[model samples]
Structures are given as structure tokens and as C-alpha cells.
Target: MTSIVGYARVSTRDQNPAAQEAELRAAGAHRVFIDHGESSRVVDRPQWLACMDYLRGGDTLVIRGLDRIAGSEVMAIEIVAELGRRGIDLRSLTEPAFDTTTPMGRALFSINAVSAQLRVDTIRETTRRGLDYARSQGRIGGRPTVMTPDRVEAAERMRAENHSYAHIARVLGVGASSVRRALGAASSR
Candidate 1:
């Protein structure tokens, strides 16, 4: 004897879950859990956690749509796999093809999940390559240096004349550490 459990969610507080609840009830769901003003990106929704706790091994978890459970394609894949591991089947009221009980539905889901993962990997690789190219072209990122060659020369001369690094920094309007480092590098050379 398997029971049908349902979960519903809305991303914002202003939106209502009435229509989704009605649909879930109409779909023969024995009990429906709901979340308001919650994002699907979060794995620990109060209603979702309650629904999971209420679910048994011989049960089907129903949702109004895939987007209700998954914020992204990667999340959809991970959630479906987790449900399968828990011996809980997933069904979508709006999508007949979203029935995990069928072989065809499982195959379609696998294809979609793999494609989404590939898209993410490709984007990451492209970004890495672009950054590497920029570095090779001498276009470094972040704030530019304030230590000019002239400043280094002046700081070195001041140090040779027994002037303190702090005094040199105050005269040049730069950091004492910068003056010290410049003088140290000149000494090292």
C-alpha cells in the first residue's frame, strides 16, 4: 500500500500556493506540504523537510512541476538520484513525462542532466582560458601599484643618508613598509 505525498513552493511571499495545492489534491495526493517566500535553491525548506520525514519507502512524492523542486538542472539531477536512493518515486502533475516509475522518463532525465552538467563545465573552462590569455598579455587584474621608480630612487637615497624609512614614507606620501622594501631591494641589488 503506497501513499501519494505532494510538495508545493513559491519563490516569493506575495505569491499564493492555492492553485498548486488544489492541483495536488486533484492528483490524488494524500497530504501536501507547502513553502511560501522560499527559494528552491535551498535544500532545507521546512515543508520539504517535513514531507521527506513523512514519506515512507513505499510512497510516491508528487510535485506540481519540476521547477517546484529544482532551482537548476544540476539540482534536479541530484534530487532525483537522492529520491531514487530513498526508494521514493517522483511524479509531476503537469508533466506526464516526469514520472520516474517509467523507463523512458528515467532515460530522458539522464540525458537532460548530463547536458546541463556539460554546459556548466564548458562555461568554467572557457572562463579559465580567457583569464589565462589575459595574464599572458600582461593585463593583470586588481588595483595598480603606487610605488613609482622615482619614489624608489628617492627612498633609497634618503636611506643612504641615515633618514628613517618612516620619514622617507611621510615625505613621499607612501607607506613606511613600501619605503623599507624599496631600500631593501636596492641593497640586495
Candidate 2:
């Protein structure tokens, strides 16, 4: 007999999985597997792996939403395709059109998956091009360094006066490690 298995995931430990579990149970899930503090980007989540292992051919895999199973469009497509290969059906409680029990649903899902992947690929390429353009214009990204030239000069003067790294850092309003690193970098140059 084919069974209905449920899978749920929460990104943080502080989040409660009770609501998801209750929804799955109400949806007639014979067994439910949950992963707490697990990111959807990770395919090797402990409970997810166990859920995949426990599933058999003809079993229906149910989830509250696609985001519970995948972090990206590529990941979601791969999972849905894998379910098809395993002779298991996928049904999303929130996304009725994603039910792959019928031929129409499967076709529509495949088309949507491809569209989603294309959008993701386009966005990534556009971002890459924008960054490249900025670099060509001599612009740099990321946060500015805390150790400026003036700070380095002051740190060196403080060190030469035989001040402790902790004292220098306190006076400089930075961390002890920052003072040490600045001094070390200056000496190296």
C-alpha cells in the first residue's frame, strides 16, 4: 500500500515546527519527518535524507511549500524530477498546481520550473555584469577597512612607546587584535 509521507524544515532553532507538523498530520500524512534549524539550501539535511530513504515507490510525498524542500529553482526542479524517477508523486499543500499526480500538473510544473530557472539565471548574469562594469570603473565593493593609514601610523607610534596592545587598542577605540594586525602588517611592508 502506498503511504503519504510529509517533510518539513525550519531555518532556525528558535522557530517551532508544531504548526507545520499539525498541518501535515491533518492532510493525512501517515509519517512526518522534520528538520529543525536546517537550511533549505542544504540538500543533505538529516531528516530530509531520512525521509528520502524511508520513501518507497508509489509513495506520495507531501510538503507545506516548495521552499521547505528547496532553496533555489534548480534545486526544486531536481527534487521534483527525482521524485518522478523514484515513482513517487509530489503534492504541495499551498501550491495546488504543483500536484504531480496528473499529466497536466506534471507538464505545467515542468514549464514553470524552467521559467523560474531562466529568471534566476538572468538575474545572476545581470548582477555579474554590473559588478564587472563597476570594477572596470575602478570602483571596489564590500565594507571599508577599519584600519586606515592614520590608525596604522598611530598604532606604530604607540607600539614604539612600549604600550601594551590592549592599552593601544583601548586608546584607538579598536580591538587588541586589530592593533596587533596593523602593527604586523606595517612591519611586513
Candidate 3:
């Protein structure tokens, strides 16, 4: 007995997944699972995981679109490949030609997979180049320090005078954590 499991997702709470669910039901879905306020980038969605668990060999998993199942084309390809390996077919209502059971569909999916891989590779290369350039220019990217040198010196003086962290913080008009961080930074240097 083959089952058709439909999965619908919306990235935000304001977005409604009713239309996708309706389409999936109209397309002959045996069961439909909806996940609202869930990003496709997250693989641990409860409804999505339930749909995956409900699928068996020769079952079909339906989605409104590739983006409904995955945030990126790479993730989409990986998910579709995993379904194929599990002997489950993946069908996109919006992309009728993306069926993995057909040769032309497989070719189209392969093209998308190759494009996604190329895009990921390009992004990795660009990030490496940008980081290398920043390193050569002696520029490090991170959050700026909240405490200034003058505040640090004052905190150190207070600490040397037997003032507790909370006391130093009260004198410096900052949080105790800030005083501790200042002391730690001074010690590290």
C-alpha cells in the first residue's frame, strides 16, 4: 500500500500554509503535515520529521515547491537524493517536471544540483579571499570592546586596593561582568 504524504511549510508566523495544504490534498495526498513559523533551513521540524517517518518504500512525498522543503537548492537536492535512496519519490506541485522517476526530470534536477554546488564553491572562495584580504590589512572582524582603557585601568587600581568585582563595578558604574572582563583582559595582556 503506497502512501502520499504532503509537507507544507511557512517561514514566518504571518504567512499562511493553507493554500499549499489545500493543493496537496487536491493532488491526492493521503496525509498532510503543516509546519508554520518554521524555516526550511531547519531540518528538525516536527511535522516534516513526522512526514519523513510516515513514508515507506514506494511512497510519495509532495511539497508545494522545492523551497517549501529546503531553504537552498543544495539542501533540496540532498533531500531529494535521500528520498530516492530510501525508495521514496519526491514530487513538487509547482515543479511538475521535477519528478525523479523520469529521465528529463532527473536531468533537470542534476542541473540544479550542479548549479547549487557551483554557487556554494564560489561563496566559499569569495569568503576565503575576503578573510585573507582583511588579515593582510591587519583588520579582524568581531564585536567591539565595551570597556575602554581608562575604565580598565580604574578597575585594576580598585582591584589592587582590595575592592571586590561588584564594588569595582559600582565605582565604575558598569556591570560586575564588565569589571570581571576588564580584569581578565588586563591579566591576559
TM-scores, each model vs. reference: 0.69, 0.66, 0.78
Instruction: Name the 10 consecutive residues with the lowest summed lDDT in model 2.
Output: 140-149
Per residue, candidate 1 scores C-alpha lDDT tens digits across 10-73 of: 9999999999999998988989999999999998999988998898876999999999998988
Residue 103 C-alpha lDDT in model 3: 79
Tens digits of per-residue lDDT, candidate 3, 138-180, equal 9987767667899999889989999999998888888999889
> How big is the positional error of residue 89 in model 2, measured in Å on the Cα after superposition?
2.3
lDDT of candidate 3 at residue 46, scale 0 to 100: 90
Best by lDDT: 2
Q: Higher TM-score: candidate 2 or 3?
A: 3
lDDT of 2 by residue, 1-189 (tens): 899999999999999999999999898898999999999999999999999999999999999999999998889999998999999999899998899988888988989988988998899999999999999999989766677899989989989999999999999899998888889889999
Ranking by lDDT: 2, 1, 3
Off by over 4 Å in 2: 9-28, 35-46, 71-75, 85-87, 150-189
Candidate closest to the true structure, highest TM-score: 3
Local distance difference test values of all predictions, in order: 0.88, 0.93, 0.88
Model 3, residue 171: what's the lDDT? 82
